[model samples]
Target: MDGKKVILAEPRGFCAGVRRAISMVEQALDYYGPPVYVRKEIVHNHHVIRALEGRGAIFTSSENDVPEGAVCVFSAHGVSPEVRGNARGRDLRVLDATCPLVSKVHQEAQRFARAGRTILLVGHADHEEVEGTLGEAPASTIVVESVEDARALDLPPDADVAYLTQTTLSLDETAAIIGTLRERFPALAGPATDDICYASQNRQNAVKALAARSDLVLVVGSANSSNSVRMVEVARNAGTASHLVSNVEDVDVGWLDGTTAIGVSAGASTPEFLVDQLVDRLVELGYDGLEIEETATENITFTFRPVWQTEEVVQP
Candidate 1:
């Protein structure tokens, strides 16, 4: 123990939803055999996707890329009706691996759209999750990426509107956008518990706490993970120097040489092994003060298979 300290943010890796989604892929492979094609990355981590690929999961960026009559699994980020339609058209045996939380947001979108409300989806327009949520009602939904987008919206002054959000966004950022949307719409409708996932909020909150007592924060996650990126933002916003690394190899000891205490956190989809690697590397570098700082306890778990999986079909 070289005397410097390491603090681990609580509720850091593999949230319930991500765990459920990955399990679906693994189970599908066991039941359906080799060559189970998965739509998109399944989760945002490249290492995760690579590991699944090694297990015989084929990842295709587009639904059309899968051959006809093949077993296809949707990624955890969810997908649009158009993608669903494409899968159906190709006669793919589709097993949806979407997190139920995301499905809930889609349900809200559909309910709002059906109730004749113009939907304001608050999220990055290009994110896969947002694209899927917006596709719930293409003609009735618009994406508001920021406060400016909310302010510049051109809907009729008296138009009925409801809003939903991408699950991986920061709670504060989404709230600010929602605040602006409400200011514009006067009577904007929305979800009761907010669409940002519980796990995302927890990791961010944990980072805030860790940042306060540490000189540097290390967020173990991937570049494409929205929640991972947001965790870095949370740490930085809390007045600590932070870096997002895919793993320990990406860690620059240079960022920690002068640091007395280090805060460590991981994205929802990040594997626990990566966090372990980071901690081990830091100890090797002489930062041996170790402490586990837990900001929350997550007991939530998902228990159900996608409806599509239950349908009677030929074994592949």
Candidate 2:
């Protein structure tokens, strides 16, 4: 493994949305002091959660878990209108940390519904984001997870249809599904812009590039992370063996058999340290040489600091 080269994919991990969400939690902690309640893991990275927890952030599954008047934040995945209402009803200090990209999807769903078009959502049924988007207009919106679901869909004969997709989806697969939907419903209206966010698309594109050049591709992201899962699928789709491992510990030495060049990338929620640790582990396994394949450059940044931090302006 000493002479083997490890190809790292650029434009991986901690997209603008994830960065904003995590910063929201940290800013809440800094501004309001600890015990700031978060509705869910701000991002999917365990290390990020643990770090925030250490700073007095409380992660819970529901608004009820937060005390009255407690500062509560919605996770990056976004929440349903009902959830937002429940938080408001509970008198919680709500600071939404939903990724703007996801919020855009929600808005699109509402727009289509308002226009009298039946909305089709391309995503897993049970995912939190999907649940939230469906809640926007459950009566008018339908969830289509695959081409099979698209084919089997039953809708009003005279209904106009529009489609919106989850931000973190396999680009190639989603395109196929979207193509099928367009074929079946020639007049189906899609989002004014691409539903898949730039970060997700760029990461998938990076993985595709890495997979084509490497013998094995290792994606660093939690199993439940949609973008991470799609990265693995993207690599496999490119004819390379791939695996989705959450962290360094999840790597099995046996997977490295006969592998020369190993490609590494991470989900948007994943942190850079995790990728670094994975590279270290790979080095330990004898893949010492390192190279980076820069597929795209990301310069996007989001800034929304808590009120307290903004007030502490000191003139130089």
Candidate 3:
């Protein structure tokens, strides 16, 4: 299409949590040399993982895979108490890089369980963050995956219950699920603040706005990234065609056949460099005009206590 443009979404890519998690790995590599063990993909982005792997970061699915007494960093998605215990048992020098927002949900789960309330956790059950939160009080926690799950709950109407959500879920969908819970459970309690992370919320909102103006929207993120997938869903729900592009190679040329304006956004865990690559490809594909759609400005940053700053927890 002649004079076609790309409308880039602001507040897209690299949230504070992802930044902090990645920084932890990079710093660990710098300070500890090669073979810094990272449990899981640091932030759901394969490119990030690959880059770190190139620089001597070893990604493992479990802390148990790491050598005893070696440096091991937990992913941004977080690990359960059981994982932490296992790390301690292995005598691993643990550097927890879980996002603070996610850590908040874990704390809530523990609190609800301590109060003897059955927890109804919202969001995808299979996600690492959900798994970690569930681990907080597995006996007392039940995962509610959808509005249907919330409606199908068989808990007694007067049962003491509390609700918590994974930090990366879609705002609208989570609201619908929570609404169903509120209707079914009159005594249900929840976090005073919303559990969805600010970065996830902001990116989704920006994508929604971008979808309204573009003929197609492409989100740059890995396939397993929850927030990236949700952003694609949000755009589709907004009545626009959308796709999740893991990199420049994933963008389909045919989707632009009749499109005039393309909306581009990235998941929170994604790096802006990936978006830049996509934009470059778009420019080469005759969609040369470019404009930025600024929906929100994000200035949040997360800092963490380094592993060296903490006492070693070697197995006795």
Which has the greatest lDDT? 3
**All models, RMSD in angstroms:** 1.9, 3.8, 1.3
lDDT of 3 by residue, 1-316 (tens): 4778999999899999999999989988988898999998999999999999999999999989999999998999988999989988999988889999999998888888999999999989889999999999999899999999998998999999999999999999999999999999888899989999999999999999999999999999999999999999999999999999999998779888889999999999999999999999998888899999998889899987775674246344
> What is the lDDT, from 0 to 100, of the residue 310 in candidate 1?
49
What lDDT score goes with residue 142 in model 2? 90
Please count the clashing residue pairs in each candidate, in the order shown. 0, 1, 0
How high a TM-score does candidate 1 get? 0.96
Candidate 2, residue 281: Cα displacement in angstroms equals 1.8
lDDT of 1 at 7: 96
Error of 2 at 189 (Å): 0.7
lDDT of 2 by residue, 1-316 (tens): 3469899999899999999999888888888898899997788778788889999999999988999777888899989888977987778778888898999999999999899989999998978889889999999989999999988888644459999999988888899899989878888998999989999999999999999899999999988788999999999989999999988999988999999899999999998999999999888888989999999999998777554433221222
Q: State each model's CA lDDT, in order.
A: 0.89, 0.89, 0.92
Residue-level lDDT for 192 in candidate 1:
80
Compare candidates 1 and 3 on TM-score and give the better one.
3
Task: Pick out the ten consecutive residues of candidate 2 with the lowest summed lDDT.
Answer: 307-316
